[model samples]
Target: MMILVTGGARSGKSRHAEALIGDSSQVSVYRYLANP
Candidate 1:
């Protein structure tokens, strides 16, 4: 499964994404992709 979170800067996108993943029961690994 894959999830993409996009929003304005400092809008808690990462935090929200992490929460979703943390609440999941089937997620085993996480890879962060950032481009600046």
Candidate 2:
């Protein structure tokens, strides 16, 4: 399974996502996207 978390810059989106997924024992893969 995959999850994509997004929000405006400096919106603490990543922190929110981490908290949501923090209790899982499964493997997680994170990918970061950059706009050019």
Candidate 3:
């Protein structure tokens, strides 16, 4: 499964995602793709 979150900088998307997945002892690996 995968979730994609996108928004302007400092838009709190990350925080919201974390909150949505809170209280779960599951394993989640984050993959970051940086464009240079």
The number of the candidate with the highest lDDT is 1
* Alpha-carbon runs more than 4 Å astray in model 3: 23-25, 31-36
Top candidate on TM-score is: 1
Ranking by lDDT: 1, 2, 3
Per-residue CA lDDT of model 3 for 1-36, tens digit only, reads 567877877788778678656745687755544458
Q: State the lDDT of candidate 1 residue by residue for 1-36, as single tens digits.
A: 788788887888878888888899994466566678
Q: Enumerate clash totals for all models, in the order shown.
A: 0, 0, 0
The superposed Cα distance between candidate 3 and the true structure at residue 20, in angstroms, equals 2.3
Q: How does model 2 score by TM-score? A: 0.60
The global Cα lDDT (0 to 1) of model 3 is: 0.68
Q: Write the per-residue lDDT of candidate 2 for residues 1-36, one digit (tens) a residue.
A: 777899999888878778767866787766666679
After superposing candidate 1, which stretches have Cα over 4 Å from the reference? Answer: 33-36
Query: What overall lDDT, based on C-alpha atoms, would model 2 receive against the true structure?
Result: 0.77
**Overall lDDT per candidate, in order of appearance:** 0.79, 0.77, 0.68
Clashing pairs in 3: none
